[model samples]
Target: MAISAQAREILDIAVAASEAKLGINPVALEVTDRMPFTDVFLVVSAESPRQVNAIANEIVDELIKHGHKRAKMEGKDEASWILVDCRDVIVHVMLDEKREFYALERLWADAPEVPIEVTPR
Candidate 1:
């Protein structure tokens, strides 16, 4: 199945929120076919642990403001790789080092990327 309109809207909000915190290389993967639980996976990188949490917090805040429930959160304590579950969109906010190590995009290479129009800051 293709990504839902609601999921795409959530992804836009999440991407904008992350970019507000200077989140790097934000990539959205349409994973409705691979993952039964969610429709999209938003992966973003940060320079430090502090930035990681900031990005994740901003995303969650924006999602909630848009009336989308914040389903779950993980790795906030470590801040190395924080996962924000927002129903149709699961956001991954990770430090640069962790992002390079995990290579989520590489792992999910088969999944088609959802193009995001990033505003230059």
Candidate 2:
């Protein structure tokens, strides 16, 4: 399944928001063919838990500002791995260590990547 235009819209908002907050190594995967729930998976990381939460919150705020409501949120308290389900896009903001451990990119290795064109904030 090709990623929808709305998924790209989410990428535009979420990736820029992530970059604005100094989130590192942001990667967008087109996962629609593999999963029915969402069209994209946006994976990013920060050096610390505080930064992880900051990135997660910023992404959610930015998307909501553009009228996108998150369907669900997880791992906010620990901030080691925060997942924000923004309808068509599910964003994973994690601590650097946790990101490396989970290796989501590798887990979804078959999913083709979608480039994020970033203009921070």
Weakest ten-residue segment in model 1 by summed lDDT: 63-72
TM-score to true structure, per model? 0.96, 0.93
Hey, what RMSD does candidate 2 come out at? Answer: 1.9
lDDT of 1 by residue, 99-118 (tens): 89999999999999998989
Candidate 1 global TM-score: 0.96
Predicted structure 2: lDDT: 0.88
Candidate 1, residue 90: CA error in Å? 0.7
Task: Please name the candidate that would achieve the greatest lDDT relative to the true structure.
Answer: 1
> For residues 69-92, could you state the per-residue lDDT of candidate 2 as single tens digits?
754789988889999999799999
Clash number for candidate 2: 0
lDDT of each candidate versus the true structure: 0.92, 0.88
Model 2 misplaced stretches (Cα beyond 4 Å):
119-121
Among all windows of ten consecutive residues in candidate 2, which has the lowest summed lDDT? 112-121
